[model samples]
Target: MSKIDSSLFMSPVKQIVIGNIRKDTTIEDLKDCFSQLIKKHDVSFRIAVDKKGKQKGFAAVSIPITLVNDFLNYNGRNMKGHRITVVLSEDFKISKSTRWQQEETGVFKTPSPNQYNSLRSMPFLYKLFDAGVYLTHPKFSKNALNVIERAQSCGVKKMVVLGANVHQCEQALGLCRLFSGSLFCTAGLGPKHAPFWTDEAETQLTQIASSGHCVAIGECGLDLSTDELSSSQSQQLYAFEKQIQLSIKLKKPLVVIEKQAHIETLSLLQKYKDQLVDVVVSFVPENKAQIVKYVQEGFYIYIHGNVFLPQNSCIKKWLTDSDEETNVPFDRLLLGSAAPYHSVFRCTDIDWYPRQFTDDTQHKSFDIMLKHCKDNYSEPCSLPSMLVMMCCMVGDRFTPRSLAEKLTQNAVTFFHLDKSVGEEASVKVTGEKFCNKTPASHHRRWSFFVVTALVVVAAVVLLGVVCVKYSVLDKVGALYNLL
Candidate 1:
């Protein structure tokens, strides 16, 4: 076979030939040895014997070129009871025809000003995996798959599917299995889905908790936005109590979804403080006082891009404040796009809609919000200092990246997720991807029409006023002559 330069090799393809296998060495033993060697070399390889009957002692192993040199350097000198010879298989070549290309050339397109603005404001938002997403909808199988795909494209790999039912939870588990490295599922009740806990629900949750797939118990909490379901305060309270009890029993971190029920929610949480591990409150309190109260009480507030909405000035003020009474540092904050599909808000102009809450208005709102925090919050920290704090919270602090690591280090850990999955799921957009692409050179074609319409209206109004004035003046002049 013709020898090729190592630089020219790209595909992961290698072949190994073993000779003089010990009589006592079973195929299992050889396989085990080869597997160990493959792992040590950080390569994947397959083994096959040349013949069924006579060539039992001789076998051929195929591995990718990526691992060939390392494998040879490390394991070629030794094999099970025999030295091994490794060579490239001449017949083997990775076919280029099977290579798949993304049909959408610019699928990973740059975000609009609004999207970029949010990203830029939160400089510490290194990637998407920093925030842990809770998939809570019953129709999440399709939506979850899509969300994961989009997140992967955006460079986010870590995810937590909030399974609302046993079947849905199993489906989420299967997805987690497929995306083994960074995908995870949380088997719990959702406020809108299965908020109330039952015996069957308990059984399902217990099974999921032990099944080694679920990471947290939640999105089970109070949502006062709806009027049809548990919209009543009493019903919401009951549901919240049951789920909290379940979380305590299961010893899992609580992934809370709070809405307009802050006072009651906080009260219940504090009441059951011993049972709770980690609490993530989303899109509930709109002002700094509420956020401060939660932080002072020891709750993790999950901030989505939506906190920057124009309507949320109070929220922004709270975000920007630094004083003990007003400010909660960004390190305590978690960044969430809440993208792909869920409707907390809508932006008609942007092609890509972030499902959670990040909109242009929200982005601007957050900027203003942080500014307010910096200006009014106790001791003034420079913008850089504030930026650093934001980074600490969203990038290395309260997020899954930091929190996951901390949980790993802590002896009394409640949340269990595959660290690798969190690492993989977190995605960072390139600067180019965040650049503004609006064509500013294009003037509004209707400008002239608007101008003409305004001029005509002004002329008409002027004529009417003149007519009224002339009529009054004529009457006055006539009266003066008579006098």
Candidate 2:
């Protein structure tokens, strides 16, 4: 597959912002102008309106991405007695918010614990769809269902399970099946496991990835952070390259993990730039220089709890440092976490969330939740909680609501996850009963899940016994005390 040119992918969204618009311009008037340009009926044309029902002097048009250039050529063209300025919505940070969440595609959750069963987030505006979580890590996988259930209770609509090897991939698929609407996964071997990559493992990887439940490939990339990898760099390269090939063959995007080997990872991704789908650089803790490189390369940055990106004027600087001619849009960011709120420092300056997102009762609930987490030894880094914290970290008196929505939108666009949650239940925009097709589609997975169901049940039973014997279930109550 020929890689799509980086230049061509400059705008990830299909919409464009048309400035200097005439107040008299109607949707049909603008549609008539661009009608001969794009044929998709789904193409939407709208004029921004104020609360007073007056036009906001600009209009927006959403069309297929391939036809973006055709529309860009309309920049500075005469329309409605004015010279309109046309720029891709990708060029603007807050403009990426989509109506996909409002679409009535069945808001699809059947009644179960998988629903937003017990969460404080029901009162909040933006529900969490955590795109990248290391679900197979012992921190989560040992008591996977209970942990996932806790996350759901925090109003997490979707989770992208990360698998570093074939065994992890199988386990990830099992979890995805168990929590059908609420989970998706990625399959790949990270740099640490590079030495374990064998021909048989590669074959197994390819087979497991064919499960259709996978949304992306990898957490795989080069990591020369340790002397251990310094010796087996060749093996790491071989593993990363093979996963890249697998990603291309499978047409799945990549979730690249880079640690110290930044340039090497960047070089390999660039080498296969065209043959690859989108790339998300994740789990790499470094400075703005590393982030600027990935952002410039048109890749998405996966943000986890361990790192605080909004401080040190990072978000403000990115906005001002960029321009239309050579824009390095900060819209290229994603959210994920490996462990639920472990090792993260609590910044006293930051509030639990923006004061506006909650009501009086919800605020009181949050206060109770915060005090509870502090009293208990357990952590409170659930995705929804982390997302709220992310808002505060960035909310230095700017568009915090839009910023949070944009972060959620990035995950939805990356994994193609659904966008909406309902009253007490969570459903995607497509009106389907489940967010994903393969897991809930018994036609495709009945036998596969039947075998795994007993194992999962046994594991839960054993987990219950261990919790009782050790009195661990008491602390488990603190986990979802976010309510």
Candidate 3:
């Protein structure tokens, strides 16, 4: 309790909470105690008191926002023979999303940097959800759980691991099982794989699509950009229509992909407009007019990490020009990284997709991944990085806080991800779940591995005992010398 006045409050300042003040402590005593550390005398302290005006063991200390970290060092230190706790109050989140909003390089206004140096340092800023991520793709296949953990560490509470085919869908499901509540997924055959959309693949995909864990249908759409991997245009259209029908039957949204096949893609979408529940386009087309058409058709626009690239001028214009009636609406916009596909990734494609992971090498996975990163790009594309870039692109139209809320809500509503985690209970996926793998088989395999490990350990111990009993160490040493 400072002696000057009872109501000393600071605005635009971080409040540091100091606790465990003794009842006898007064304004002068506290000032003298803290004056050495903060000698400027501009900082203020307010101790909460009981009805009887007795010390209430905690006080709100307002210091220069920059000095918060320095003042935090007093935590757990002896103060009047008592260990006091010092911590930052929940004051930094006023403009949580706005703090991380960055403008394009050489452009700045509305959103300035926060007290923290990096976007990752802003704890509350990480809550923005990443709508799409290829978490089970080759780029992240080594440590399947590693990428998910990293994403969650930075405050990405939710993510959708999209699959381009049935196996990949199962793979996403397998990985998602480890991070149940936070991860959702989609099951669909991409247009490139349209040729393989056999009845069995369709049946498998349909089964996978039924899971409550599966939020939407498709990575399926028209892709005219492929040469070797892409199916014929007609086949792509056929697969797209079928998937749209599937989405209609399942009543789930469609997570679509498109590359240079805009006219055909839109036509098929129009053909099924009445039956389709929802549609999410992964990439923005170059034609601004086509964008208007897609928006008019109620397709949710996905803003990927690549929007900042010079080639995506149309998307940039569409996003920044909020006043345009034909522009993609904020409510219909979603954010994705399509990561490992993003430019930040150093991926060499064999087909349209990144090189698949093959477990042929028996070495340290980290070393291989590290070498891959060094050879290609420095860091794998992360959700948080995409969030930063997208916010920067949209910062011109909206504040970071407002934009973050809009995008977050868009993803939530688009995917229906707000459904209860236990909702998967309602629709049980019957056909071989997670590809052909089952939970019982997984546990049985693990049990076998454990038994084998125990046997190996026992054998090693027996061999060591026999060697020691027979003096094999001396014999081996002598034999080595003789050799």
Candidate 4:
């Protein structure tokens, strides 16, 4: 598929063709399996069975170019029992393209534990969670249900359901109702390449917000990339303002989607600063100053696993430096795997870049902040202390025990969630383990041993050097005296 130049104002339809199914797999079964992958992303494609009525164990899925980029950056690596392959199907010539194309989908391969551990050891990337993503059309009820089931099976307690269409919203609500405490939905209007939300859409959103099921007020924001359904600066502003105001009025948090309209979005946000709660900046900025400005303003930096980006990019440098001084706290940092949708943004046959950052870098980042916190905060400083500092400095000043708690608080306080439902939805996420081991204790046990070894080596070298210098000096002094 042709690269959808995000720099240009063109909306390209990026497709993911899943092939090599186990021939006997029925369309319903295939759909059931693939539905979970697409529900959390913005995709446009249909499912079809081959002539043999057997599951080819492959699928051809097309997603919005933006989503494709996200998928490739985050969750493009492994799926199910298969290391799912991603291919460009747009240029392929197929005799019968019955929604399903016969393109060569790569074989399924799972990484061994050693491979997983080795990959983890590479740099700063750590396995935060095994995320189960769902990408669904707002109208697909059955698909939504399947996704919820799949997420549960995968131990994914947190979920993000894309699209703001009424049916999708309803399906989301249904999932929340069924799962009760397990599921939470992020209401979004999608990109400019796709349909924008209408006033009726707002009403439905408002209704959903009132239901206590909807936690955040977006996947709604601006996308200047797609020319297919272009949005003017004014239109984007108007939409953003409406959602912001809705969030404020409903007392719910807002999730923004921005692409190339950073300045405009920030300007508008500053204009209505009081109304906006938490902001998740999806794409990392190229400019260092802009990142600092956002961090200073208090926005959680959502880092995606994109191969093109380095672990110690300028942003990470800024984060490291910023942590030392209390310029911005560490609790505000959050990691998200922008999965399923990222499958299409592959260059060669490879899809989904491995998670970014090395294990050492990841540990160092955390360690530096912990040390800083220990030195600065009082004795009562707990993990929550670190989390609170991080959240307030880097992200919004609200840190709940779990994602669910945060979502519930966001829902009740920002969205005017139904009183009863909101109360029931409330939960407490487990706190991070606090290290009570003192520095002195660590020093005595480990630092002393290290220092002693170093001192012994240094003493030996110093003695050898002194002996040689004294021997030469003594001979020279005797000759001078004799003269």
Task: Provide the RMSD of all predictions against the true structure, rounded to 1 decimal.
Answer: 25.5, 27.6, 26.3, 21.0
Off by over 4 Å in 2: 1-121, 283-285, 309-330, 341-381, 393-400, 418-483
Top-down lDDT ranking:
3, 2, 1, 4
Candidate 4 off by > 4 Å: 1-134, 137-155, 193-195, 226-231, 307-328, 343-423, 431-483
Best lDDT among the predictions, by candidate number: 3
lDDT of 1 by residue, 143-200 (tens): 3433443344333334455555555566556555545545566766666665455677
Candidate 3: which stretches are off by over 4 Å?
A: 1-122, 227-231, 344-381, 422-483
CA lDDT for candidate 4: 0.46
Candidate 3 per-residue C-alpha lDDT over 327-347 given as tens digits, one digit per residue, 9 for 90 to 100: 558889887756656542332
Q: Per-candidate TM vs. native?
A: 0.48, 0.56, 0.55, 0.45
lDDT of 1 at 380: 12
Error in Å for residue 325 of model 2: 9.2
Candidate 2 residues 180-211, lDDT tens each? Answer: 45677778898888999999988888876776
